[model samples]
Target: MPGQETDRRPLSAAQLGVWYAQRLDPASPVFNQGGHVDLHGPIDVPLFAEALSRLVAEDGTTRLRFTEAGGVPAQFAAAVEPYVPEIADLRDTPDPEAAARELIDADMATVPDLEQGPLFRHLLLRLGEDRLRWYYRAHHLMQDGFSGHLLQRRLGEIYTALAGGTESGPALGPVSALLDQHDVYRDSAARKKDRAFWSRVMEGAECPPARAGRPALRIAREISFISSEQFAALREFGVRAGVSWQQVLIGAGVLHQHRRTGARDVLLSLPVTGRLTPAARRVPGMSANVLPLRVAVDPDATCEALMARVASAVLRVQWHQRYDASELIRDLGWPADGRRQFGPVVNVLAGDAPPRFGGVPGTAHLLSTGGTAEDLGITVTDGPDGGLRVDFTVDAAYADSVPLASHRRSFHRVLDTLTGDADVPVREVDVLDGVEWGLVVEEWNNTAVPIGQETLNTLFEHQARIHPDHTAVIFNDEHTTYRRLNENANRLAHHLTHCAGIRRGDLIGVLHDRSTTFATTLIALTKTGAAYTVLDPDFPDTRLNTTLTRNHITTVITDTNHTHRITAPHLIHTDHDTHHHNHPAT
Candidate 1:
């Protein structure tokens, strides 16, 4: 405690990343992390408060205050008063649970003042005689999801000892211990190696497909749980395939992205607990780093092969997981332009189990995990009933733009596929369920309508009779009335039949520019009961010749400018005067 207030140290790389993010949007509470623990049976509120205070005093991270020292962000342990839980007797209110939830939400929405000392809050609500809810909220710069669980476990240990009239376990190590460990690693040769490994992994990588909306702090969450039977099947499959369930989940995520976006190479942010050293693990501060797992999916390969690939990538990432992702971004020269390097985050929360409270039945419920930089996050954790729970936190700005329910269903279908046949090809895995399939393939594609048997030429003639003086064609600032267009087409048809011996069922080639003459030629050909093949003037001569020969077209109608491009045995120029005399007046 000698340098408690005076000793200022540079933030750890993880904390520094969060510091910059918070500074970018100081007023947004998107960086606030919060959760609540519902205790079914609890009584000693006073003892609980004392235990929390003692825990706060022992953990140096709880007393940390951040400020800019010499124009650089630094953190120091402040000798502040011990943190006390704000007790609320909500038992008398109508719907005490609802009241407590509202309180927690309001506190989580508050933006913490980084320089003003305390960056965390504790609230204890009494719902009934035996029911209680304990809420905790902290800034991301102070703690992460792992640290949150650590603090809860330690607090439970202290509270249990106090209640049992026994000595508590050893206290959490000081924050400086982790800080020193980080400093040593930062300047170590291993750091250089990590940088190189990450550089190689991220080489030739581009940002994931852009999401629907801009980056916003507010989020919409959808929570669902996998059935115990399905989870069991998944675990069994993983075991037989020699991979962990976590890897299977990650592979499923990659497959989902591939199926969703059709991107062969998919990138997902995998959150790694940056507790490489014992000190970093024991201190319980901000020690989480996100690793970009780039999975190259081969659609032709089996799902088992994809899982093996994912497992290998995950193992490699775990080996080099100490490197901070923010540092990697800076080293890679990626600008902070709000474009995400990875798609949805595939987070596997396998370790942070619910903390025990003096043999009391308590359930942990996460309220918020701060604002997500990525548009979507997929969190997989152990469900309450021996199953797996998946929570999707999507950007609120894109909640309407994105299909959350459909995505959930798609991911579930992927999980089902993984749990069933390992030999299924990646491309053959169906993401959509039957209902979604119907929507996409049947309902959405329902475009059929009854149609008369009138041919194109007859329809045009009917329209011309009804609107003779109306403009029927407009090209290059010239307009032709329906009557004149019909007359011209009739004359051309008569000329083709009488002079060129053109008859029904003949395949005629129309080689012309996109002009009124082309329209006239098509109508004339249709009037003669002959099918016309369009030969673009822009096409090469070889292609034109191929089209004519392939269609067995001996006669072709062309304009004066394009007459040389046609290779038909006989050619009739639209501008030629020879055919004009053969046609009768219409």
Candidate 2:
């Protein structure tokens, strides 16, 4: 990869994570951005081409799969060639967008790269004979926010080295070795302890605040932002109350939902940075995972009480992020086949570091909350001034109406308690808006169906009613009917309670895979009025044993064909017909 100069630097690990994330998100503009990348500057075309080739060659851990390893579907260089002007005289147009328009009409955008990836082509606009700003517009498949940063940083360094007559560059270290090393670490004994740590945090988990369906949240064209004075006041209040900015925001987020949907129990899916371990922090990819923090408050719950619960849940989730999102979902027994059950998420990544190169004068003030559920997302970015810029993208159906606006205002007031100090606990702030107070009060008085309760089981039962016969359990050639589902559940219930001494208040733990018995056991446990815990067989034996001991589980009902092999008082294999229904002495 040689032209004449410059060995470029590569993207750091954290930046690369964000880059790959955009690749996976359908809603991301990056999903269709690859076709629009254009490189413009006053440098030798051959030199820049070589620079780009070198940039791709440096081999950031994640990019190699799509770059040089014979792994991706197409050559990135070829897809990019069309975007380069054959021989255009360079000067800045009054608007960079004008150049963008011409390039799109040129049909260079249709070219594909990396198989499924779109072409990453760019038009070189000569800027002052020495510098350039590569006007980039590419589908996310080619690059993400972080990848762009990596490219710019490395390109600048490469150009600088070339100008200085350096024939060699700093060789790339064992970067390619990181992926396999990480995989090995993931399956290691240390990872087992980490998994156990997370399991403890999610022991009695619940889903977060979300609307039932996929109806999109309304996004406003014209948005008036909160003032600096208002944000300051909130910061002061949060400090006095003893919670972080996040707790304060979460409290306010719950209030917004209550005002918008009239639901009270706040189950917000808050995103946490998934990079926790020392090793994880070094390799960057989309490592943000979420946790469902349950905030149970009556319509009359003071800001203080609500904030406290949200804060505690946030702490535990952060401490246990090692178990990634996929692991958390399975442990929670949530469906992953794309029928969305998880609620809307609230993410705050306020650090000011967008993609920038040495030539660019100022930093690119990019504020994005990556990919999120089609629910209400409250993203707080570092504002132009010292204040915070908070963007709330709600599902269009739940637009901020009059009542919702008032709830939004009241939430800001809670932040008012924080203006004096940057830190204040969420619970200390008070929501005293008369209209909002009365609206929530009326809902509470009119019916016991409080707003918070709706955030939980209310919709679940309705889903069951609507889709009862829709393949509740699909075991090998044996589908359990919703009707028969409950009957088999009762049979298991009688067997557990009467024969195995599992009573109304007992906790029965089932080690399982996705099967009819697992579903039936779940139903039976519900019927018997006993709480049951599900541990995937993939979980380490030690971890499962810890849950058993912690929950005081005496009987573990699993099948012999699909088993835990752990000892219990009565190992009742479902394959056996010796199902007894006699009640054991309580």
Candidate 3:
């Protein structure tokens, strides 16, 4: 028999985050996650009900509720009636499979109330004379992915034993004990060390922006699969590189994100099973946590080197996986203005877990886990045919199907590049598919033009004459009118042509800081019909001098008299006043 004493305890750090999120958005179904199991071969309704009741009576979490224990809300044991599974009979309904799907949809639409006891709910639908579908949903505060998997097996055993006129195995302790263990972990020295490790990992790191825009409803999803050959190649490559397949996938994901955002450092949120002890594993509660994986993707690094770094990082993080994600974010001292620390999350599902229910042989299918809580969520699972299925749930407002489609294509291309040639540097990998390459080479860059008598300077002159009073450019508090800019460029053009002997097809070097004078000089180059070369002032003297010399003779134009690095025949310098004063009309 279970203890009669009230098992009360504070919420775990992860649970506290979930509670706060639930309280903030009461209508969101993100925290409500569940799966359904298909039980074939005649489910005895009454006996199944009794088994569900017995299971609830034995497990303390099923009969658990939340209330104010001392000024703060905490979980405690609640005395509630035995859970009776709701039965939806659709055997006689037309299109039984379709009708059964409607019943499942309706049950999933009903959200659970946290304040009420029995956070876990169940629904059994009759598909035909011998087919039954069982759906189970529980608040994330009570269950994780592993717990859901374990529950299906446990229910199978209970129903099987009852059907055989026997009893199931002894029940375990209350989930409240798991919360107690979590509290103990919070106060341990190991937790302090984990905290320090995360602090170092996340220091000076900013998560990348969402690849897609946020949709109004934000409920779009896409699933892509990789070939069995590619999946096998990934594993074989991992073995050769001394890394796990998960780390290899993560490394590939980081490289993908880098190619997408052009960022050297990538930060991703990864989910880990927080089953720190064997007792916690059997308790069937919310023992999963999300942690940040920060990696620096050096473009010059080889694929093996990058995978090795990711593997080492994964191992170190798993050692300190007990650190509370919510608390770690708090300790990072980031602003609390409703922005999440990470934009994308990657999860690997337990697809290999066998469906062990009773003595009957049937299949278990999970209808839905909660939709993504982040802008983009990628879930990987092993397919029934031994391949890998990757589902991407994205916020539509941030990204469209077009880009994500290409993203999926590029992801495969990247994997091929990595496994095809391990010696190539990451920067050398080309993610574009063959079609994209053909388009770029044959269509996009096919820039053929008709010869025209008109020049760029003539076009600008026409626009200035038509809209002379229009604002041409604004830099800081200064504005240049079209007429004024045209006259200024004409003045510089005359100086270049008459004074500096600049003519058509002459190559001139123009070096200046970002200002109105630089714009004027570029326009003047068009008027003189001379090809102009631009250089950043910040480039090293050796590179600048070498580039100037390799390009041959040069006449340099600048806003300042700093031409010591460039060996030029003539140097023309000009400056303009940018002190908020608008240039008067020409």
Residue-level lDDT of model 2, residues 1-586, one tens digit each, is 1121122223223233334443444233323332222333335555655555565455342232233233322112222222222334445666545554575445332434433343344444443455443444343333344344444455556655555557434533323233344456467876687677656655655443233334331233222256677666656556755787657776667655554455555566676654455544433232345656555556555555566666786787676654545555666655442323345556664544433222332233332332334455566655655566666555344554323354446556645543543333334455657765676677557765546645322343454567777666666567655655555666666877777766777777777656666776677777677777776664445566777778788777776643545655655556322123322121
List the candidate 1 regions with Cα displacement exceeding 4 Å: 1-3, 209-214, 351-353, 400-402, 438-586
Residue lDDT tens for model 1, 1-586: 2247678888887787778767766788888887888888754888888887888888777678899988899988777574677899999999998898788878888997787757888888999998888888888887888887788888889999999999888889887787787888989999999999998998766644455435666777888999889888988878866788888898889999899889898888888887776656668678788889998989999888889899999999988999988677666555444435456788887535677778885577776666575456888866766777798887676787566787888999898898887589999999978898898899999967554787788899999999999998887567888887888889889889989889999988887767776787788889999888887664446667887888789988887777777768888887623223333221
lDDT, model 3: 0.71
**How large is the C-alpha RMSD of every model relative to the true structure?**
13.0, 10.9, 10.3
Candidate 2 similarity to native, TM-score: 0.50
Candidate number with greatest lDDT: 1
lDDT of 3 by residue, 81-190 (tens): 65677888887888888987776666666667776645777887788888777777887777777677767767777888888877767565567677777778878888
User: How do all models score by TM-score?
Assistant: 0.73, 0.50, 0.68
| Clashes within 3 Å, all models in order | 1, 67, 8
Off by over 4 Å in 2: 1-56, 59-178, 208-266, 277-284, 293-315, 337-342, 353-361, 367-370, 394-411, 420-586
Instruction: Looking at model 1, report the run of 10 residues with the lowest lDDT sum.
Output: 577-586
Q: Considering TM-score, where higher is better, how would the candidates rank from best to worst?
A: 1, 3, 2
Write the number of the candidate with greater TM-score, choosing between 1 and 3: 1
Q: State residue 357's C-alpha deviation in candidate 1, in Å.
A: 1.8
